[model samples]
Structures are given as structure tokens and as C-alpha cells.
Target: MTYMVLLAASFGYVFLKAWQQRNVAFDHVWWVLPTSYAMAVVEVIVVTKIVMTGGNWLAVFVLGTGGGFGALTAMWFHKTFLTRRE
Candidate 1:
């Protein structure tokens, strides 16, 4: 369950941050920092809870793996959706 949350938070964090960067690059008014901060807070709190509760470090590893996938997916999405055609 916590792993699921971690996965989701990581995915959302990367997706939103990447989306924001795409928008910003185009001179859009969308601000990504506040929402990205919220996502970071979620990650921090979840990790803290896991550590404080003595949860398995394996789960943390899984979370990190999820985050890596999330970042990759976000990059792929940006390249796919934000690109313009001639």
C-alpha cells in the first residue's frame, strides 16, 4: 500500500514537473514549483514514515525504482506530446 503511494507520488511528481517545464519553455504562465514542492513533501513524509516505522529498506528501494521509471516516463511523454510538427 505504501509502495503504491510512493509509486503514485513519484509518477505524479515527475509528470507534473516535466509538464511544467514544457509549459515554461513555451512561455506559459503555469507555475510548477508549488505543486512540485507538494509532491516532494509527499515523498519526504512517506519516506520518513517508512524509516520511523522501521519498514523494510527494500520497499524504499522499490520506491526509488518507481521514481526512476516515473522520471523516464515523464521524459518520454514530454518528447511525444510536446513536440511540434512541420
Candidate 2:
């Protein structure tokens, strides 16, 4: 459950940050800073867990799975909430 939540947050923030950068000229989105910070925190937890578990293949595989889930979550959020016709 913890992994699922953190994975979703991490991926959502990454997608938000990338979108902010790609769609702007010199403007800044205040929300992106906090999202980036959250992603950093979640990644630290994930990395520490993976490393403390001896960096085995299964651990790495689970990490990858978490990341993939994160990406999917981000994509879904972007499509459902962020996209706008312009």
C-alpha cells in the first residue's frame, strides 16, 4: 500500500514537472516545485529500501514495477485532469 501510494505520487510529479517545462517559455508553475520535492522524497525512500535489501534482482524488478506503475498513474492523471484543448 505504501509503495503504491508513493509510486503514484512519484510518477505524477514527474509527469507534472515535465509538462511544466515543456509547455512554458519563461513562466513558472508554483506547484511544480512541491511536486518535485515530493518525488525526491519518495525516490529516496524507494532507493533506501532497494539498497538495504541487498540490491538483488527481485528487488530491482519490484522497483521497476513500481516505476512503471508510477508512469501509468501519471499518464492517467495527465489525460484525465491536466489536458486541455488549446
Candidate 3:
């Protein structure tokens, strides 16, 4: 259960942080600071869990899967919601 939640949260926040980065690049500061802080918090917890689990293979795989999905989601989200089309 814990791992499941963490898996979902890991990808969710990574997506958020990536989206925030794109926003920041375009001078969008409103959400950047908070997202940065949130990302830091999430990373700490995730890394701690991985280390504490003795680098479990399942955990590592989940983390990598989350990251890959997060990156792709971020790109899709930004293009779908943030980009201004001419």
C-alpha cells in the first residue's frame, strides 16, 4: 500500500516539477518556487525509502517507471495546456 501510494506520488510530483520548469523558463514564477520546494521534499522521502529498502529491485523499477511516465506526461501536459499556439 505504501509503495503503491509512493509510486503514484512520485510520478505525479515529478510531472508537476517538470511542468513547473517549463513555466519558469517562460517567466512563470507563480508556481515555480512552491513546486521547487515540493520537489525537494518528495525527492528526499523517495531517496530515503529506496536506501532504507536496501535498493530493492522492485522499488528501483517503480521509481524508474514513475520517472519515465512523469517526463512524458509533463511534455504532453505542457503542450496541451501551457503552450500558446500561433
Candidate 4:
């Protein structure tokens, strides 16, 4: 499925970035943004698919929004706190 491919790509990106930037302590965190955003998009797509298949739309919306926000918050924290400290 498209989701699987996207997930794999994100993983690959993370892996390559980590490998290439192994000397930098905060480099992994920077590379995480792409994976995190891809995951959020995947969550939205999955939720939409479930809703279209007769699942609860409200639940889907709630979960998708929460996941997206959570990922963004995590990225923000990593940038603001973790990266800044190093």
C-alpha cells in the first residue's frame, strides 16, 4: 500500500541521515522531522480511509488531529530544548 511505502521511505531517510550525521549529537533529531511529518500524513490518510469504510468519523478526526499535533509538539521540543542545549 501507499502508506507502507511512505513509512518505508521515512524509515530509510531517518536511517541514512543518522548514519551520515553520526558525529553530531543533535543531528538525529533534525532528521526526525521528515519521518514525523510523514507519519502524521499517514495517520490522516488511514483515518480517512477508515471513516470512508463506515468507521466513526469523529473518532478518526480526533485521533488524526491529536497525532498530528503531538508529532509537531515533539518536533518543536526537540528543536527548542534538545537542539538548543547542544
Candidate 5:
């Protein structure tokens, strides 16, 4: 359960942060503000949970793996679904 939550939190944290950055770069204030707010909230939760519970090597590995996939998926998701191309 802990590992699963950590995985999800890490994935969400990275995705929102990356999405926020993309929104900013594209000059989309509407997207930027909300993503920023969400990212901050998630960041707080992820850090607090990890700090309070502590993790073994396996948990740490899961966190890293989730983050890696999150970043890759974020870029693809924003470009493929969010961006408007003409």
C-alpha cells in the first residue's frame, strides 16, 4: 500500500510539475496557474509522506522508476493531447 501510494504520488508530482512548465513555456496562464497550484499541493503531500514513513531500498527504487516514467509520459501527453498545432 505504501509503495503504491508513493508510486502514484511521485508520478503525479512529476507530471504536474512538467505540465506546469509546459504551460508556462506556451504562455498559457490558465493552465499554468492551476497546474502550479496542484503541483505544490502534491509536492507537499509526497514529501510529508515520505519523510514521515521512511523508505527502504525497494521503495526508493519504485519512486525513482515512477518519476522516470512520469516525466516521459508528461512530455508526450502535453504535446500529443494538449498542444494545438496548425
Candidate 6:
């Protein structure tokens, strides 16, 4: 549905952008932004849905914190692994 389409489009955009900047060593990092944005959007949707269903704010806060940490960890790992060495 909409989620699937959004996922596909996000990944497609990442792939295209990466391909377009294939010559640059760190260009792939650009892909991470779109992926992160997509995930953030999904997280917001899930949180809103949960709130609408009368879920606790504590649960939403925990999920949001976890998601943010995961995204930061991913970005760190990507930078560590993909960046060119001196």
C-alpha cells in the first residue's frame, strides 16, 4: 500500500543517487539520509497511530528514543566503514 510505495521510492531514490555519485567515495552516505527520513516518517506514523489507539505516552517515548538511537548507530557505522582512509 502506501507504506510499500514509500519504501520503494525511498530505496529507489537512494540507489539512483548513489549510482549518480558513484565516483565519490563518500557519496553513499547521501543514501542514508533518505533511508533515515523514511524510517523517521514511519516512526511518526506508528507513534501517531498508537496515540490514536490510546497508547501510553511512555511507550511512544521509548519507541522514539530507540528509533533515534538506531538511526544514529547506523550512520556511525556507515561513516566508519565507508569513509576513505587517509
Q: Tens digit of lDDT per residue, candidate 4, span 9-86?
A: 334334333333441555665555565666566556655555454655554454445445544555555566555452
User: RMSDs, each prediction?
Assistant: 3.3, 4.0, 2.0, 9.4, 1.5, 8.7
Specify the highest-lDDT model's number: 5
- What is the Å distance of residue 1 in model 3 from its true position? 2.2
The digit string of per-residue lDDT tens for model 6 on 1-86 reads 43333334344334433433432455665665565566566556654555554656554454445445544554556556666688
Alpha-carbon deviation at 5 in model 5, angstroms = 0.3
Output candidate 6 Cα RMSD: 8.7
Superior by TM-score: candidate 1 or candidate 5: 5
Clashes of each: 0, 0, 0, 0, 0, 0
How many Å off is the CA of 71 in candidate 3?
Answer: 1.3
Backbone clash pairs for candidate 1 read: none
Q: What is the lDDT of residue 63 in candidate 5?
A: 78
Computed on alpha carbons, the lDDT of every model, listed in order, comes to 0.66, 0.57, 0.78, 0.49, 0.83, 0.50
Error of 1 at 28 (Å): 3.6
Of the candidates shown, which would achieve the greatest TM-score relative to the real structure? 5
- lDDT winner, 2 or 3: 3
Q: Model 3, range 4-82, lDDT digits (tens) per residue? A: 7557767976887788878878676776888788888888877776766677788878877887799789989888987
Residue 16, candidate 2: C-alpha displacement in angstroms: 7.2
How far off is residue 78 in model 6, in Å?
A: 1.1
Candidate 1 runs further than 4 Å off? 31-56
lDDT of 1: 0.66
Candidates in descending TM-score order: 5, 3, 2, 1, 6, 4
lDDT of prediction 4? 0.49
TM-score of each: 0.57, 0.65, 0.77, 0.36, 0.86, 0.39
Q: In model 4, where is the ten-residue run with the lowest total lDDT?
A: 14-23
**Cα shift from native, residue 5, model 4 (Å):** 30
User: Which of 2 and 3 is ahead in TM-score?
Assistant: 3
